[model samples]
Target: MAVGALAGALALAGCGGGNDAGTSAGGAGAAAGGAGSTGAVAVKNVDGVGMALVDSAGKTLYFTDQDTAGSIKCTAACLGFWFPASGNGVAGGAVAGLSTVHRPDNGQDQLTFEGKPLYTFKLDTGPGQHEGQNAQDSFGGTTFTWHAATTSAAAPTTTEAPPANTGGGYGY
Candidate 1:
């Protein structure tokens, strides 16, 4: 099937040395961020999806079914296509429920939404692209179903807004 082939190719690409970007986990939830990460997240009204969390570049954010409250399943070959979304802000996107999770694979904090790890589709050219929504793929023996992150959480009580956009699709 085409999906299988694409997954295979992506997995192979993962073995080609390094990624297009140096993916890093900054932080998750209220947890503090680690070194080599600067997370800046915001909510944007995308075309296909209503309001979704976006990176500094305004690229729509996604979450995987494989990632749980305490587990980060997208690793190794998976990182090629699903660039991790890392940020230090506990309050995500003008709303509460934003946090970080420490990734055992890489020893960094990964940003999460209401406990689910967040990611951005590498294939998406730019902001407003929801190509990753409902997408099915596999890498490194792990199957993943991705969906756009929804901005449905209640607003945070604090007045501090998320950090200003710094202009990188994947957390830089």
Candidate 2:
């Protein structure tokens, strides 16, 4: 997909991936593609995290230090606050290292970047929020260090909260 098109897709899908699972559809990050779809995965600068992978609604996607490669480690209680980002996991444009994995819990495809399972934080009510970054928590016998998924190695500089739009939209 073109750069602008990817951003638009990310915007539509951005807010859709919240606690609500509205409707099911097909696409990367779009197991459900209505108002609550995960939409598409895209690279964008999120507040406090710099250039990183975000969901359709601009919510920062993260990886847990406790997770095994290609396998999910968070379950039950942990899942309540951290939601798996459902997607086909193919992000176009300058974004690379995109992939997907099947979740045994729900039979849905979860998005992964650079081989780490990606998730969104429930406290982040909107896009571009990185409320889960560097958070330390334990669930299901695992201790997790949540970190934002980034495409760069430069030190991230926190910025003002992202603008409301941030390019995410609904539907496909």
Candidate 3:
């Protein structure tokens, strides 16, 4: 198997390793994707990421492979750059796959999509910046690659190779 395929397995293998599963993502966050919202969260077309979910301030939401259905590998120093989305931030519309889960380390609730926890990047300071895209970070001992949260329930099937790590990975 390819390295990507192998790592994918390890990611899934680490599932249910976080706090007890809160409401299933399917139950709490599951729904058809939409472009309506009056507060909290809404859909926006992001550069490079296309139609993705954004926070009230328009910060892009992201997830990581290091996290599983009920697991969150991003903590500690990892949070220095990747901030968790507030669980109280409702999609406020018909947006699908949006929900919240309680953080095991901190009893506070965090938002999630498709069962994976959501986060906002501190590096994305300017409008339309997604420096977090594919940025690798290690939490504890697990490594993660960040990606924007999309409104669609189904991810695009791709065969392209991941970009080269010429810039080096996140060491924090």
Candidate 4:
């Protein structure tokens, strides 16, 4: 009886080893595809506008138009469309006044300037395309828009001018 019990315990230990092997294999697969690995953002000075963050292949990342710091108001579905570019671990260097902001939700380091969150558009599949820019109407009830960063000293400005009077005579 003692020998039988010892043999059964050894069998159980072997079964546990098989489970561990399965887990390790699963982890290896995930790491291979860069699924959990974070890619770093490369920030550079483009012209004189400000600092812009790009991917490893030099793709531009979009910034929120709002002028705030450390807080990103985008949540839920908005996050689904515009995903933040993440760094592997280290904070990247600053450029054109923009700095790195760590996002707690995804453990990704996002580029921020004047305290706004940065993102890349899902629709933009190529480099140098600022598809996220001026996308204010995409999300209903959300007042978010994209702003392209430039190294230029003068920021792009848009002013609402007064409506012009139509000179047509009425009530004749």
**Prediction RMSDs, each to the true structure:** 14.1, 14.4, 13.1, 18.6
lDDT of 4 at 29: 23
What value does the lDDT take at residue 111 in candidate 1?
83
Residue pair clashes in candidate 4: 48-151, 48-152, 49-150, 49-151, 49-152, 50-150, 50-151, 68-115, 69-115
lDDT of 1 by residue, 35-106 (tens): 222358887677656777887767778898888968788875466567777776532435567788888877
Provide TM-scores for the models: 0.66, 0.65, 0.63, 0.51
Residue 6 lDDT (model 1): 55
Off by over 4 Å in 1: 1-38, 90-93, 153-172
Q: Per-residue lDDT for 162 in model 2?
A: 55
After aligning candidate 4 to the native by TM-score, how far in Å is the CA of 123 from where it should be? Answer: 1.2
Q: In lDDT terms, how accurate is model 4?
A: 0.49
Best by TM-score: 1
Please provide, for model 4 over 38-111, each residue's C-alpha lDDT reduced to its tens digit, 9 standing for 90 to 100: 35556554332234556664556666664244566554334544555445322365354656676554455665
Candidate 2 versus truth, CA RMSD in Å, comes to 14.4
- Which parts of model 3 are misplaced by more than 4 Å? 1-39, 87-92, 153-172
lDDT of 3 by residue, 17-62 (tens): 3232453232221222212112387777776677777888787888
Supply the TM-score for candidate 2.
0.65
